[model samples]
Target: MEIELVNCECCGLKEDCTQDYISEVKAKFDGKWLCGLCSEAVSDEVKRGKKSSFGMDEAVKAHMSFCGKFKSNPAVKVADGMRQMLRRRSGDLSSSSSKKFMRSAST
Candidate 1:
């Protein structure tokens, strides 16, 4: 029942989760806790790696390296955030502009 702040071993994402939840995640990721997204990615990697010699540990390490690369790039992170924001607001932006056009036309 106690909530604790925990950081994902792979991505360093912080989440306030119950102790039980943290333990569960750690147990799943070879005793290293991963965030939900990282865990899913690792799971997918494991499934795909079945064709080769890859396993859970390898997937976790590969994902950790991938996340670490992104952490070192501030510009990429900003650009990515802006891109996501624009994508989400695109519909609103378009509709608002159309409304402004209609109002001007009626005036």
Candidate 2:
């Protein structure tokens, strides 16, 4: 199978994938190619949209719009990722501390 470098429609992330794989991904995303992360985000959006009775096209458009906002600058994207990582780490630390506090209180 031949491999091709494909740019994601949402995040502009480039991935080397086989033509068959690329075709499969495009087929799943309403003919637009998305990277793995964007695809998962879109899939989640579709699930969330189901609760509001929105269709796949609307979900895709919403996700594309969200991604478009952040795709303009690489520095901004990196900073955003760092911010999210820090937030997750802080949350984990707080939860661990709370667990320790509970243990100490029980003892």
Candidate 3:
């Protein structure tokens, strides 16, 4: 298995990967190779079926644009990614103090 250095199309992260693995990722993401994290993120979007017309190409493009915005600062990139994840898991954070769950009065 020959190892190749590949850069992620979306997040600009680089990794040493087997040629077979790289080709497999390119096949899945429209000829662009993505790192594990990015591929998983894009895959998640596809699985959600949030947009009827969205597909792998669109998801890759969307993530690429998102990563582009944060490429200058790796710290900010991670922070923003975490924020987005939190929002996705906990609903929108627009109302900071609304409430997550009612306080169970079991005292």
RMSD of each: 3.7, 6.1, 8.3
What is the C-alpha local distance difference test score of candidate 1? 0.86
Enumerate clash totals for all models, in the order shown.
0, 0, 0
* Global lDDT of each candidate: 0.86, 0.84, 0.80
- For model 2, the stretches where C-alpha displacement exceeds 4 angstroms are 71-107
Give candidate 1 regions above 4 Å deviation. Answer: 72-97, 100-107
Which of candidates 1 and 2 is the stronger one according to TM-score? 1
Cα lDDT tens digits, model 1, 57-102, are: 9999999888888744433465689999998799789999999999
lDDT of 2 by residue, 17-106 (tens): 999999999889889998887788889888887878887778789888888776373334766899999999999999999999999999
Q: Give the TM-score of candidate 3.
A: 0.65
TM-score of 1: 0.74
How displaced is residue 104 in candidate 2, in Å?
26
Sort the predicted structures by lDDT, highest score first.
Answer: 1, 2, 3
**Residue 90 lDDT in model 1?**
100
